[model samples]
Target: MLSLCLRRRRSPQSSFATCVLPPFRPLRCETLERRHLLASVSLTPIAADDQFSTDEDSVVLGNVLTSDRLDGSVAPGLTLRVAEWNGQPVGSSPIFLPSGAILTVEEDGDFHYDPRTSADLQGLAGGESAVDTFHYTATPQFSQIYVLGDSLSDQGQLFAATAGTFPPDPPYDQGRFSNGPVWVEQAAPGLGLATTLANNFAVAGAASGTENFNESLLGTDLPGVADELDAYLDAYGPTADPQALYVIWAGTNDFFLPFSDPAPVIANAITNIVSHVGNLQARGAQHVLVMNMPDLGSTPYGLSDPVLSGQLSAISQAFNANLAATLDSSGLAITPIDVYGRLEEITDDPDAFGLTNVTEASFDGTQVVLDPSTSLFWDSVHPTQRGHELIADLVLEHLSDQGTVSIDVSGVTTVPTLDARHESGQAGELELWLSADDASINDRNGPFEYTVDWGDGEVQSVQGTAAGVSLTHSYDALPVVTPEIRVRDQDGDSSVALREVVIWGTVGSDRIRIRPDAGGVHVLTLNGETVASLDPTNVDRVVAFGLEGDDFLSAAGSEIAVEFDGGDGRDVVLGSRADDRLIGGLGSRLLELRGDADLIGSVAASRLR
Candidate 1:
């Protein structure tokens, strides 16, 4: 078998080198030198009869020829017939080969071999050579992540640019505005990439367009997202790595800057951001993640003044709506992260997410909070480390949902492990701790997919890269339930963990009231104790059971349907205005009808009031 190899040039400016492989005979390792090195090489075996044809078996040579370097020159014994062979392949153009393979050469001389039908090679018979000429094209693998944003994503660029004067290291971790590593840094590991794999071009207070607001405030001009893109293009050339991930998160600072009319300000911000995405797509960026702005009005800075808070909130909503619509219409492979929704969720119910203070900043510019772990914001405008973790969680979950990143548990002897603990002080909420022993073997920090079966015919799906996640479910009827949790990696390999939990209910006689609101159904005792709150949008139905008591159940003026079971008692039940179900168990019961309701058990066993 003979092989044809293409190697990248040593010089960054140089293109590609084509090499000829010797026949299936052993050659001394020293005989092959750096000039014949190959990277990302693909080899297809030809017939021993000297005819180039496809075989059932082919050897893939990935990083096998790493020791040798290649100068931009073709070796002897091969006639390369590519279009404009002066050197570099022109922007991933396809070059058809006679051996049923489509060779695509990227601008950087990376080779991609796509095998077509083996029947195409049948034409070359009776010792005829495979091809008179050959063309080549290939795509490069995703190498690194490129980030362009404001202080939310800035690593050390602003600190270095400012000579470490602003955001002192004591309160701020290194150069970040936050108390610790930002979202991007926290997310890198989950992506199976090191922090260095992310090339961060973000700076502090960068607007969507060409201006840096923070730099201007400091009486100097620094790079914004636009300038950052230009600098990246200058360094890496116009043809970017098509497989790499590019993140663009801006527009927060745009809202912060003074503007007479928010309409034009929002329009300009979306326009600039869309323009940046277009530029990236034109330069061969295939995977791009754009994060929308969070609620600026809810920040401590905005909360200081009610009017300003309302204005900022409105502007943020308008900007996000427009940005989403614009990106959708543009028809690019762009994934928009809902930073606004995620932050709002954390703020609305802080306890559900292990957060205590969402409205106050941990750092007041002069003093730091006693425990910054539970606080959402470091300063008035920037998120603390805990907030950053949640943001990272949102990003990882989005990426996993889009199939950009996944957990890999294949080739592991030990399966993934999961542990569930009840979240303290929160009813119907459980904290799941998941980890795979195989995670570190290959540096695989996973975006693992978690499926939680609450064992009451209700299941929930959550995604995370870290070890801990929180999930909630309400059980109105059952006294106990066994919940099962499954953590699956990208390869579909999974591990299941189960825990039995006693639900919130009383065995004694109790007064139960079921009510439905716009959000969902609420189950409570007559004493105002919450039995369960079920969101119909998330769950299928709302159910409640009256246990051991001659319970008086009422579902008056309810807009949604509910189910109630009177257990071992002469119970009095009031039906809802909507479709409802009532069950009488083991005792005489009183059934009250309001709307079209279904009655269960023997009607003779129940008495009408």
Candidate 2:
């Protein structure tokens, strides 16, 4: 069996010489925050200098974090604690420092911080871990696959009592739909294949390169699908590997939630996944195949949307056309099933395919209706067990003992990691390390790029190669905001990590101003809040906060200044914007509101002075 292979190019910018010298075990310089239980529940004062230690089963719980080795020197007397709330664990309280910030964590287990979720806990473990060191390295010998669109792909559910495993339901029952034979099972024996040809990755209402009906209505369980795929692939071989036969019978939902930009969205997602598969191939298994779109117009969902029926058909045509072109461009050789044509034939005459009474096998003029004993679809969407088998058979027939397939991915650059600070003033920076398992890294092209929003509208960016690098950001104390960080790979693909920062100051009293001009704008900041902004809408009497503290000031068409009451008690001058003066009598009646903005002084009279 000859196989075609295309080794993509590697960027030259990251042309680093491989060096081998010492056996240095990786040390955890930054420990992740972990959740802990409280041994004793109480609202007592736990002083910083105080030490309250407990065992694993103790009622009073605390998260103890040890300082990492800094320049080979460990910080001393650094035991920290994160208290538990109720029965669960909340994040640690701020660990105030004289110079910088420090965080608390659990010392015993593996913890990873997800900038996305904001809370730190046990990171993905076991087979779920993203580490790719244990994959096989032998190239695959086959590429044939059986494509099943959705649950109705197999009609085994029709014989639910006969088949002990398959279930009978509106979505899973093959009895209601006509396409009921296990085509792959029948074809595999004739094809001389060593493994099963069918792959039922299709869930009810699934779409191509996107989520299914259930996943969207519910939610894509984090790391669930990817994690399961990883584990399954870890134990699977290309001879019968699901990867080899990329069967996707989805996109019934795309009609409902069609992509505003379908081509690129679908293309990019496929490329991302296929590139990963190539990475898998580089690790060993070969042979790859993918399925194409089915005829939803024949299904209940397609028929339901009368106005959208034509539109859905057009979208499906366009999507498949682009998909074929994209795969062709990528040098990936996949035999697409003429699902639309087949479905059209089936709908025109269900009897030809052994299906019966599918004329009403449509819903709302858009979705497909299912008829057991003949049709492949289960509902307005999805496939039956027998449908799955037919898809499998088609894939099996394509794998004749011949031809080489090559996929070139050298033009793509690989980014390895990302690092970011939690918030402007918050503790701990996030470091994300991304790796292209089998691809070469390009320093110039970069591992990726990162953009940080420190919750105060401050933005910062860094190239992917800038991993392990640190940058500082600022945040406001009031109007508590969420800190969001985004990382974009060289391919312009991006993911976000979100966190929240607690500001130490208030808003109303902190008088800051942002002056607007024809071109330029003046900004005033107090703590981390921009209490007021200047624009053409409100052209006069702008009230704002100070740059760094709680103080109020008003600006008109003149230079900005602060107001003070004369003949009153001595007013405490916190700070100033410019070289301004302040004078008042000795302590008589001077009051400053805390977290409040209330002024009793005459502004016009004091301004004249």
lDDT of each: 0.59, 0.35
TM-score of 1: 0.44
Tens digits of lDDT, candidate 1, 1-609: 232232333321112233444543321222112111211111111111111232212211111112222222222221111112112334435555544444554333234443322233322222333332232211112357899998999877888877886657777888888889999998765454445412888988788888876664455778878998988888788897765778899987775565445667777998999899889988777667788888888988778767667656766777777777667667655766778889988988999889889988888767786467998888877888889999998876644211010111112222455544443212343344444432322213455677888787889887776365677676554443456667765434466454332333255666667566555554444436665554444433344556556767677776445556666677777777766666666664787667775766545456653
| Model 2, span 1-609: residue lDDT tens | 111111112211101111222333322211111001101111111221112322111122232222211111111322222222111233445322221212222322112221112111112211221211000011112234433343334334213323432233333334323334444444443332223322433333333343443343333331222332343455454334423434333433343333343445445544544453454445543334344566544555556556445444555565555555555565543334555555665667766667664534322222334444455644435444445555554544343211111111112223333333221222122222332211222232445566666556667777645333355644334433445556665444455343322222232234322333344443344444553333432221122212222343322222333322222222233212322223223331232322222334322222222
Where is model 2 more than 4 Å wrong at Cα? Answer: 1-171, 174-212, 216-229, 236-264, 348-351, 356-359, 362-371, 384-393, 396-609
Model 1: residues >4 Å from true position, as ranges?
1-142, 196-198, 401-609
Clashing pairs in 1: 34-68, 34-69, 103-137, 104-137, 104-138, 105-137, 105-138, 112-138, 407-490, 509-549
Q: Model 2 — which ten-residue stretch has the worst lDDT?
A: 131-140
Per-candidate TM equals 0.44, 0.33
Q: What value of lDDT does candidate 2 attain over all alpha carbons?
A: 0.35
Question: Which candidate tops TM-score?
Answer: 1
Name the 10 consecutive residues with the lowest summed lDDT in model 1.
401-410
